[model samples]
Target: MTPKLVAGIEPPYYTAVFTSVRPDAPEGYAETSVRMQEIVREVPGFLGYESARTPGGIGITVAYFRDLEALDKWRLDTEHQAAKRYGREHWYDSYSVHIGKVERSYGFERE
Candidate 1:
Protein backbone atom coordinates (compact mmCIF):
# COMPACT_ATOMS: atom_id res chain seq x y z
CA MET A 1 0.00 0.00 0.00
CA THR A 2 1.21 3.47 -0.87
CA PRO A 3 1.35 5.37 2.38
CA LYS A 4 -0.54 8.61 2.77
CA LEU A 5 1.95 11.46 2.95
CA VAL A 6 1.27 14.55 4.99
CA ALA A 7 2.99 17.87 4.40
CA GLY A 8 4.41 18.38 7.86
CA ILE A 9 5.60 14.89 8.72
CA GLU A 10 6.41 11.39 7.39
CA PRO A 11 4.10 8.69 6.01
CA PRO A 12 2.77 5.27 7.05
CA TYR A 13 2.50 5.80 10.76
CA TYR A 14 0.72 3.22 12.95
CA THR A 15 -2.29 3.46 15.19
CA ALA A 16 -3.63 0.68 17.45
CA VAL A 17 -6.97 0.63 19.19
CA PHE A 18 -7.73 -1.92 21.89
CA THR A 19 -11.10 -2.10 23.58
CA SER A 20 -12.26 -4.42 26.35
CA VAL A 21 -15.00 -5.22 28.82
CA ARG A 22 -14.20 -6.33 32.32
CA PRO A 23 -17.29 -6.14 34.49
CA ASP A 24 -16.13 -7.20 37.93
CA ALA A 25 -12.39 -7.53 38.06
CA PRO A 26 -10.63 -7.89 41.39
CA GLU A 27 -8.34 -5.31 42.94
CA GLY A 28 -4.77 -4.87 41.74
CA TYR A 29 -6.05 -5.47 38.23
CA ALA A 30 -4.72 -2.11 37.07
CA GLU A 31 -1.36 -2.82 38.63
CA THR A 32 -1.04 -5.95 36.56
CA SER A 33 -2.32 -3.94 33.61
CA VAL A 34 0.80 -1.78 33.80
CA ARG A 35 2.88 -4.89 33.34
CA MET A 36 0.87 -5.81 30.25
CA GLN A 37 1.47 -2.36 28.79
CA GLU A 38 5.18 -2.86 29.26
CA ILE A 39 4.98 -5.79 26.89
CA VAL A 40 3.58 -3.53 24.16
CA ARG A 41 6.55 -1.26 24.63
CA GLU A 42 8.72 -4.05 23.32
CA VAL A 43 6.60 -4.34 20.16
CA PRO A 44 8.32 -2.90 17.10
CA GLY A 45 5.98 -0.01 16.24
CA PHE A 46 4.67 0.75 19.68
CA LEU A 47 4.48 4.54 19.62
CA GLY A 48 2.15 5.36 22.48
CA TYR A 49 -0.94 4.06 24.31
CA GLU A 50 -4.00 5.58 25.93
CA SER A 51 -6.63 3.78 28.01
CA ALA A 52 -9.80 4.23 30.05
CA ARG A 53 -12.40 2.14 31.97
CA THR A 54 -16.04 3.11 31.90
CA PRO A 55 -18.98 2.55 34.22
CA GLY A 56 -21.06 -0.02 32.33
CA GLY A 57 -18.49 -2.22 30.55
CA ILE A 58 -15.95 -0.45 28.44
CA GLY A 59 -12.17 -0.54 28.20
CA ILE A 60 -10.38 1.31 25.44
CA THR A 61 -6.73 1.64 24.35
CA VAL A 62 -4.95 3.33 21.45
CA ALA A 63 -1.31 2.79 20.54
CA TYR A 64 0.45 4.92 17.96
CA PHE A 65 3.48 4.05 15.85
CA ARG A 66 5.77 5.25 13.07
CA ASP A 67 5.00 2.54 10.52
CA LEU A 68 2.38 -0.09 9.69
CA GLU A 69 5.01 -2.76 9.08
CA ALA A 70 6.25 -2.23 12.59
CA LEU A 71 2.68 -2.55 13.81
CA ASP A 72 2.34 -5.86 11.98
CA LYS A 73 5.53 -7.08 13.55
CA TRP A 74 4.09 -6.18 16.93
CA ARG A 75 0.89 -8.09 16.22
CA LEU A 76 2.84 -11.22 15.39
CA ASP A 77 5.37 -10.90 18.19
CA THR A 78 5.86 -13.90 20.50
CA GLU A 79 5.50 -12.06 23.80
CA HIS A 80 2.48 -10.27 22.41
CA GLN A 81 0.97 -13.62 21.55
CA ALA A 82 1.42 -14.81 25.10
CA ALA A 83 -0.11 -11.62 26.47
CA LYS A 84 -3.10 -12.09 24.18
CA ARG A 85 -3.54 -15.61 25.46
CA TYR A 86 -3.38 -14.35 29.01
CA GLY A 87 -5.93 -11.67 28.26
CA ARG A 88 -8.28 -14.25 26.81
CA GLU A 89 -7.90 -16.49 29.85
CA HIS A 90 -7.53 -13.96 32.62
CA TRP A 91 -6.70 -10.24 32.21
CA TYR A 92 -9.47 -9.04 29.90
CA ASP A 93 -13.01 -10.36 29.43
CA SER A 94 -13.04 -8.99 25.87
CA TYR A 95 -10.97 -6.61 23.69
CA SER A 96 -10.42 -5.31 20.17
CA VAL A 97 -7.69 -3.47 18.26
CA HIS A 98 -8.19 -0.96 15.43
CA ILE A 99 -5.20 0.37 13.51
CA GLY A 100 -4.91 3.44 11.30
CA LYS A 101 -2.49 5.97 9.88
CA VAL A 102 -1.73 9.19 11.71
CA GLU A 103 -1.73 11.82 8.98
CA ARG A 104 -1.17 14.74 11.26
CA SER A 105 -0.66 15.78 14.86
CA TYR A 106 0.25 19.07 16.55
CA GLY A 107 1.76 19.93 19.90
CA PHE A 108 2.04 23.17 21.87
CA GLU A 109 3.02 22.14 25.36
CA ARG A 110 4.87 24.85 27.33
CA GLU A 111 8.54 24.02 27.51
Candidate 2:
Protein backbone atom coordinates (compact mmCIF):
# COMPACT_ATOMS: atom_id res chain seq x y z
CA MET A 1 0.00 0.00 0.00
CA THR A 2 1.21 3.55 -0.67
CA PRO A 3 1.82 5.81 2.29
CA LYS A 4 -0.99 8.00 3.53
CA LEU A 5 1.30 10.95 4.22
CA VAL A 6 3.86 11.08 1.42
CA ALA A 7 6.65 13.62 1.20
CA GLY A 8 9.67 14.63 -0.89
CA ILE A 9 9.28 14.15 -4.61
CA GLU A 10 11.04 16.39 -7.18
CA PRO A 11 8.23 16.88 -9.67
CA PRO A 12 4.59 17.04 -8.65
CA TYR A 13 1.98 14.68 -10.05
CA TYR A 14 -1.75 14.20 -10.20
CA THR A 15 -3.43 11.35 -8.45
CA ALA A 16 -6.78 10.21 -9.73
CA VAL A 17 -8.76 7.34 -8.38
CA PHE A 18 -11.83 5.97 -10.09
CA THR A 19 -14.07 3.22 -8.89
CA SER A 20 -16.99 1.77 -10.80
CA VAL A 21 -19.68 -0.84 -10.48
CA ARG A 22 -19.17 -3.92 -12.63
CA PRO A 23 -22.79 -5.06 -12.89
CA ASP A 24 -22.32 -7.93 -15.37
CA ALA A 25 -19.17 -6.50 -16.91
CA PRO A 26 -17.02 -9.62 -17.08
CA GLU A 27 -17.53 -10.09 -20.81
CA GLY A 28 -16.46 -6.53 -21.60
CA TYR A 29 -13.59 -6.12 -19.14
CA ALA A 30 -10.90 -6.76 -21.73
CA GLU A 31 -12.49 -4.43 -24.25
CA THR A 32 -12.87 -1.71 -21.63
CA SER A 33 -9.22 -1.96 -20.59
CA VAL A 34 -8.08 -1.72 -24.18
CA ARG A 35 -10.18 1.34 -24.82
CA MET A 36 -8.92 3.04 -21.69
CA GLN A 37 -5.30 2.32 -22.60
CA GLU A 38 -5.81 3.83 -26.02
CA ILE A 39 -7.43 6.93 -24.58
CA VAL A 40 -4.68 7.36 -22.02
CA ARG A 41 -2.08 7.32 -24.75
CA GLU A 42 -3.93 10.07 -26.57
CA VAL A 43 -4.14 12.30 -23.49
CA PRO A 44 -1.41 14.94 -23.34
CA GLY A 45 -0.18 14.15 -19.84
CA PHE A 46 -0.46 10.42 -20.37
CA LEU A 47 1.26 8.47 -17.61
CA GLY A 48 0.06 5.13 -16.33
CA TYR A 49 -2.98 3.29 -14.98
CA GLU A 50 -3.67 0.33 -12.77
CA SER A 51 -6.96 -1.57 -12.56
CA ALA A 52 -8.40 -4.58 -10.82
CA ARG A 53 -11.77 -6.26 -10.42
CA THR A 54 -13.43 -7.47 -7.29
CA PRO A 55 -16.66 -9.28 -6.55
CA GLY A 56 -18.45 -5.95 -6.22
CA GLY A 57 -16.78 -3.65 -8.76
CA ILE A 58 -13.70 -2.43 -10.58
CA GLY A 59 -11.14 0.01 -9.21
CA ILE A 60 -8.90 2.14 -11.44
CA THR A 61 -6.20 4.61 -10.52
CA VAL A 62 -4.31 6.56 -13.16
CA ALA A 63 -1.24 8.65 -12.35
CA TYR A 64 -0.31 11.40 -14.73
CA PHE A 65 1.51 14.76 -15.04
CA ARG A 66 0.77 17.94 -13.08
CA ASP A 67 -1.45 19.81 -15.45
CA LEU A 68 -5.09 20.45 -14.60
CA GLU A 69 -5.65 21.68 -18.15
CA ALA A 70 -4.36 18.45 -19.59
CA LEU A 71 -6.52 16.54 -17.15
CA ASP A 72 -9.57 18.55 -18.20
CA LYS A 73 -8.69 17.96 -21.81
CA TRP A 74 -8.67 14.25 -21.11
CA ARG A 75 -12.07 14.58 -19.48
CA LEU A 76 -13.41 16.11 -22.65
CA ASP A 77 -11.36 13.99 -25.03
CA THR A 78 -13.43 12.87 -28.01
CA GLU A 79 -13.03 9.18 -27.50
CA HIS A 80 -13.17 9.41 -23.76
CA GLN A 81 -16.26 11.61 -23.84
CA ALA A 82 -17.96 9.07 -26.05
CA ALA A 83 -16.87 6.28 -23.72
CA LYS A 84 -18.33 8.18 -20.78
CA ARG A 85 -21.64 8.36 -22.54
CA TYR A 86 -21.46 4.69 -23.40
CA GLY A 87 -20.54 3.90 -19.80
CA ARG A 88 -23.62 5.69 -18.61
CA GLU A 89 -25.69 4.02 -21.28
CA HIS A 90 -24.28 0.55 -20.71
CA TRP A 91 -20.86 -0.41 -19.27
CA TYR A 92 -20.85 0.87 -15.72
CA ASP A 93 -23.69 0.90 -13.23
CA SER A 94 -22.11 3.80 -11.33
CA TYR A 95 -18.74 5.40 -10.65
CA SER A 96 -16.90 8.06 -8.67
CA VAL A 97 -13.86 10.19 -9.45
CA HIS A 98 -11.43 11.70 -6.97
CA ILE A 99 -8.68 14.06 -8.10
CA GLY A 100 -5.90 15.57 -6.03
CA LYS A 101 -2.49 17.12 -6.52
CA VAL A 102 0.60 15.59 -5.03
CA GLU A 103 2.56 18.42 -3.52
CA ARG A 104 5.27 16.30 -1.91
CA SER A 105 5.54 12.53 -1.46
CA TYR A 106 7.90 9.90 -0.14
CA GLY A 107 7.86 6.13 0.41
CA PHE A 108 10.36 3.65 1.85
CA GLU A 109 11.61 1.34 -0.86
CA ARG A 110 12.96 -2.14 -0.15
CA GLU A 111 13.45 -4.82 -2.71
TM-score of each: 0.67, 0.74
Misplaced by over 4 Å in model 2 are: 1-9, 24-29
lDDT of 2 by residue, 8-93 (tens): 44557786778788675556656876887787777787565555667766656555645787688778778777877877787787
lDDT of each: 0.69, 0.69
Best by TM-score: 2
Off by over 4 Å in 1: 1-12, 24-32, 107-111
Poorest lDDT segment (10 consecutive residues) of candidate 2: 2-11
User: Model 1: which ten-residue window has the lowest total lDDT?
Assistant: 2-11
lDDT of 1 at 37: 74
* Candidate 2: residue pairs that collide: 6-105, 7-105, 7-106
| Candidate 1 local Cα displacement, residue 85, angstroms | 1.6
Residue 25, candidate 2: C-alpha displacement in angstroms: 3.4
Predictions: Cα RMSD each: 7.5, 4.3
